[model samples]
Target: MTELPDTRLFDTVLVANRGEIACRVIRTLRARGIRSVAVYSEADAGARHVREADQALCIGPAAAAESYLNIAAVIGAARASDAQAVHPGYGFLSENLEFAKALEAAGITFIGPNIEALNVMGDKIRSKNHVAAAGVPVVPGISEPGLTDADLIAAAADIGYPLLIKPSAGGGGKGMHSVFAAEELPATLATARRVAAASFGDDTLFLERLVANPRHIEVQILGDTFGNVIHLGERECSLQRRHQKVIEEAPSPLLSGLDDGGAVRARIGAAACAAAASVNYTGAGTVEFLVSDDTPDEFFFMEMNTRLQVEHPVTEMVARVRGKSLDLVEWQLRIAAGEKIDFTQQDVTLEGHAVEARVYAESPAEGFLPATGTVVVLEESVAQRPGVRVDSSLARRLKITANYDPMLAKVIAWGTDRREALDRLDAALADYVVLGVPTNVEYLRLLVADPDVQAGRLDTNMIERKLPDMAFRTVDAGDYAAAALAARKVDVARPNAPGEAPAASSWGRLDGWRLGDPAPWRSAWAAPGRTGVVTVSGPQADSGTEGPGVVHVNGIGGDQESRTALDLNGTTGGELLWDGQERGYRVGMLGETVFLGSGGWSVALERLDREAATARMLAGLEREDAAADPQLRSPMPGTVTVVNAKTGDRVAAGDVLLAVEAMKMEHQITATMAGTVHIGVAVGALVKADQVVATVEPDEDNSTTIPEGE
Candidate 1:
């Protein structure tokens, strides 16, 4: 064990990122009594991270290019606040070699591995070359620098069919594509290049043989300036979507076999430590690998993330630092300050099983499409036991925009065994509630509860394979009643608030009530964007028992009516109770949007007029005017910065109609059906969610559907 330094690493630190990871680092800084500074973009003017920090500065607008990625602005903010160190929390500038160089030149500590390791390991291709030369087993691929499209295609042919194209400059599945056939290469290559350039400013790419159904295993390591390094075991991160991990567990379940006792785990850990030592790496970093299913003993070096991983909690939960409450961020801070790690590899030990589930704001059922909306209600369950931890940046009134990754919260659970840890994780997932936008919580619930996941019969493609069987859990009539009742309760509670269009007296009055008489007023209430009204009936606010009572919700999409009876009379203080069910609920409402939540599962309902919901449903079914071209709308709010398709441009389904920039990420509005396009917006036009940006003529036979330039 090396000795400690007398001087503190940094008295004040500036976090050069936003969202949950920023807040996550701030937690340790606060615990250590270190003053923290935060930088935010215009979109995150009121972000939770901004409020949590001791001080904050605005860098640029919503786009990350002008803000979080704007190295100069971040440095200026840090200097202005007199911060001694900068923590790039897991994204944005976390892995940028230039950022580290800039911070070093500016005489401010960069709380990560030094610039040398970042340069060598940050570039995927270069890292592979370096590690393989150091005797690490790497995946078979073509990684020649400056390869042309033809050269890449020829290399792909040599690598055989079912190759993967990945951006050399970035990870997190961005700009990564799987080419299963020769025909898919051209388009896949084009899209990959575009995404790579947009995401990392460098479109340098590499090709690799696609390891089918391989389990993703990554080892966490901590190193210090004194050449001492330690491994914190491995995390099973096989479950992924589009190459990004969704769920992660420590002490990899996949590595457990009947006869092999810890040999494979030891080999992988030593390989990881060797990989780190080869780079002379310091601070917290993750070395990732892809182990083939058939040959469980063999593992190939995938890539090394030279920053704290998003799933670090799973490793932290399992591996406890003796005699310290320190986490990875703290270790990074100490290591950056030239402090030696007090413990060696022999001091570290994996205690028990732990699991982490990433609860994203995106909908898994809808092609895992990114959805953005205001968080109307955010409720987190307190983990009384040591097993549960939720790392999140969500707060009520927080707006989840499309300009960034759609991850909302992470639910982590630790237990004495795998089954107990899984049970705790499932309970935590059920208790995590988020509303006002679609989420993958329910899907995640079904996923963990699946037998294959429990048995650890998993791979990268398991989620995709099980998705068809895991269509979103059916919403019961009682669920509908609860959501509707909650939404209506909000509407009835607020009468004088602005932006609320007053409803007509006929629809507003309680059924069975006239002037000065007690009557049960019945009015039709509709679920937003659906067909039938629940026909909710309750007393007026001024009446004795002024609240929603019995709701006679009609059956959904069938002849059967009155699906469930709900006694929503006293569903207040954020709770709802149905007549038949025994499960108690907590409810929250924002304007007409209500989030009914309980046990970590939540659903959002919009209070809609019976006529409006019916009208919307009819419009979808009856594209009656075949001649009238359908309009393309922005599904999420953002500024229209690019319109690719012009009028009369023929396009197939999924063609980019336009690109909207929100929360620093570009959400391309693509065509749902094949058609000729008539773009409505120009570059630099700010657009709202669902605002019409273009129109498409679906009738292939009709060329004259769109007027010329008018």
Candidate 2:
């Protein structure tokens, strides 16, 4: 066991980050009795992390570069807060050498690797060269960051088709693109360069051979200043979308062959340690690898993240000794305080299997496009649940802006084995709910139950191959009828028998009025996306929103009609006895949307007036069509960085016309048809979601099909 090398523990610590990661570190600091300081941008003034920290400071405005990524601003905040050390979370300056050096110059501690270690591992090209010199295998490719685009094109020819263009400065799947042909290199290259520059402040790029149908495995590395280093086991991160990890699991299933103590795990573990020790790494870091299923014993280095990873929970769960997982952030603090690791490799042992699913605010049906809205209601929590944990940044009424990453939270579950863990994870995901924004929750629910995932047959290409078959569950005709019934039942106050005349409006309301037999109180409602009519008739007097009443519901689209007894207690839940089973759901009214939430499903119903709904729908259709016409709107909110095409400039389809940036990632705007361009927004101007940035007047003479701009 290594002893304490020095005694200089920080009394106050500042976390130079935001969101769930900052909250996570604050929790550790609280446990250690260390004063916690948090910094936030204007966009996150009242965010959860700010409220949780012991002290809060405003760094800058909304944009990340002006706030979190501003080294000077972060250091200034640290100094103002009187923090002795600063912990940079997974992203945003976590691996920045300049930030560490600045802290060092100011006599402040940066809780990561040393400057030389960061300089070596932070650069993908340099790290590859350094680790390869220590007898570690790397993906074969050209990695010269100084190469020109033409030179890169030449390099691609020798490397052959089906390679990847990657930024040399950062990972986390940002600015990484796969090329399938020689002709696609230039456009993909330009995109990678722009994204890399915007994301990592470095546009230098390189070419790496793409490993097809490979499993993503990463080892956790920890070291101290006394030259003692050890490695935790590997985590499986093969489930990915657009090169970003979506779901991760510990104890890769491929290592099942080596469960009886084979050399495979030991070999990979030693390699990761060697890679870390080569640069004298300190604190927590992760070394990612891509291993082929055909030869699980052989693997190639992908990249090493020089900071704590987003998937650290799974590793922590597997590495837990007692009821609590090891305080990795505490270890980070100790190492930063010049303390050495107190335990050897033999002290660490595997406990149980754990799986983590990253939940993002996106619509899977729309190609997983990011979405933003206020969270009306949130019921996700893992506090009371056993073997389940949720790390999130969500609060009721919290508006999710399009200014940062789309990831909302992570749900994790641990069990005695893989099946139990996955099953628990599925139930936990279903238990999680969010309203007022489109999310991939339902899509994730379906994914955990997939046959291949259940059988542990996973690869980086799993989601891409099964995407066409996946869909988001929507409310059906029955749900609409139930919604209409519930709506009318709760709105009536005066009682009228089944054959009595309909009640007139007490005040100035014209809703819930009818003039026919069997008409007690009639109302019409419509589902959001479906064009149909649903009507409900109920007893007039359902006092206090609950009474014994016979309700008749009908839907015109499917000719669905039903008569049943319903107890509508305003927002309180009722039961529906249908098709041999009784289903219970809680009914809540949110403006026009009616939410029927239950165990495993939630359906939203939009209240509609027959006349107004029809007119407004027609108007909405007109507005949508006009919005999609010649006007080219920005898909997301961002600042316009460059406008390439001018008014009256004739351009072919797919020509880059403008570029907008958000969260430091640049998005290019292209012409949909061969046409003359009419630019709307100028460079350096700020634009909101769906704001018109340009217009493309389609050239009638061209015969080639025009693709729509995203």
Candidate 3:
């Protein structure tokens, strides 16, 4: 390690990001006695990060491009706050060369790598070539600038089948495709190009030979201006969906389970250090590698992330420096101030095991569709428990919209070993609750408890392969019973019946009360794709008894009814004797809908009226009559970016009518039947989840197919 002159750290730093990462950075800044400034958009005015920051300023509106990604606005915020430095906490402009350059021009320190490192490592094509020149092993690939489709087609034959198509620009698994056969090249290339252009504004693409049963391992490295860099072990991130990581763990189980694990670890760590040294990388960075699960000793360099990573907490939990835990954020701040690292590579040690699960606001059962809703109930108290850590941006009444990423928070755990860490993580998730918005919490719990996952049988495609077999628990009799009981317990005043006068006395109750016994009150409840009713005959008020009573519930989509025993002790929720066991749940009401949550699973049951129920039945009948409904609805709330069909356009079934993009994920709305299409939305228009964006009138005789090239 090279020695360097001492330099004072910045007095204040402006965080050019939002959500949990910003709050995470502020925590270290506050510990170091540095003032932290937060910048947010119009949509995040009341966000948790803003409230926690010492100073906050509004930069722009909700659109990320105009707000979080606005280079001018972010720089202006830093300038106005007299911030000596700015921390681009992952995502947004974290790795943008222009943002770093602008900060340099503004005389503010960039709490990340220098511009040179960003330029080389930011683009996949350039980084591969740059590191390859430095004698680093990289996956076999064809990379070049301005490679036309024709050129790629010619090169595909040489690269062979099972090749990965990746955009040169952007990160986070966007615009990535895998082609297993030659016949799938042309169309896939076109789609990849379009996504690349839309996402990163750069259509430059490259191809690499896909490593079968590949495992993603990334080393956490910290570098200083003194030309010193050290690794903090590796993280296993093989469990993913659609190329996005769902779960990550530190001190990869594959390496730890190997006979020569320490030797392989040293070699991989050295290669990562070389990759960073090639560009003189400074501050905290991650060097991702593609390691074959069959041969753990052999690893290939993938890419170098130029900023702090979302899974850095896992590394922090297990990495100790000089017998003390390390804070990567603090090191980033210190490195940016020209301070030299006092510890060497041999001084770093891994103590225990840690695991992290990303809590995304998505419906895993609905093809991982992004969800939108206002957070009505929150139960993040699990973070205070032993061995559990939660980095979240969730707050009560927080509106989870489609304008930003779907990641709501991250739950991490540290234990004596891998099994203990996984156990803690699963328990934390089960205790975690976020109602009013659908989340993948239940799916995450199922994943951690998977047999293959627990056995360390991990690969990039494991999650995708196991999804078909994973049984995701949804709304059941317990959910309906809890909703009905919660509704009965509500004390809100009820309006008089139509043309009926208000009660003259307390004896004249409007709540189905009688002289001898209160009549049973039946209420209908509806969830997505299902509806049920529950009848309660007992007293509306709590009995204050330990014994449980029973309520009859009509199963969804069936006439069969069953009795469910529930104990309501005047609490927000009740204990349900369900699935041959007594289970407890927490319940809250948002409007007429009751949200019940337990064991990391939640459901929103809405009070349904008789007229609405009848209409729903009629719609179900229509669906039964025609297999194709002709209605194209936006699967998620987002902005409509592409409108492929216009009104009166004859289209064939499976033709894409429009695309709605939210949280960087695009879901195409397709015509269900051959017909004349009527597009209801245009380009750049905001849409709601499940909102009807287009409709098609079935006309099989007049339907026409779209040209392949078009």
Top TM-score: which candidate number? 3
Error of model 2, residue 88, in angstroms = 1.1
Which one is best on lDDT?
Answer: 3
Better candidate number, 2 or 3, judged by TM-score: 3
* Lowest summed lDDT window (length 10), candidate 3: 540-549
Q: Model 3, residue 402: displacement in angstroms? A: 0.8
- Candidate 2 lDDT tens digits, 260-310: 434788888889999999999999999989898777888888888989999
Taking the tens digit of each residue's C-alpha lDDT, what string does model 3 give over 98-141? 99999999999999999899999999999999999999999987
Query: Which TM-score value belongs to model 3?
Result: 0.94
TM-score, one value per model:
0.89, 0.87, 0.94
Ranking by lDDT: 3, 2, 1
Q: What lDDT would each prediction earn against the true structure?
A: 0.77, 0.78, 0.86
Query: What digit string (tens of lDDT, one per residue) describes model 1 on residues 87-143?
Result: 998888999998999998999989999888999998899999999988889999998
Error of 3 at 107 (Å): 0.8
Q: Superposing all C-alpha atoms, what RMSD in Å does each candidate have to the true structure?
A: 4.7, 4.9, 3.6
Ten consecutive residues with minimal summed lDDT in candidate 2?
540-549
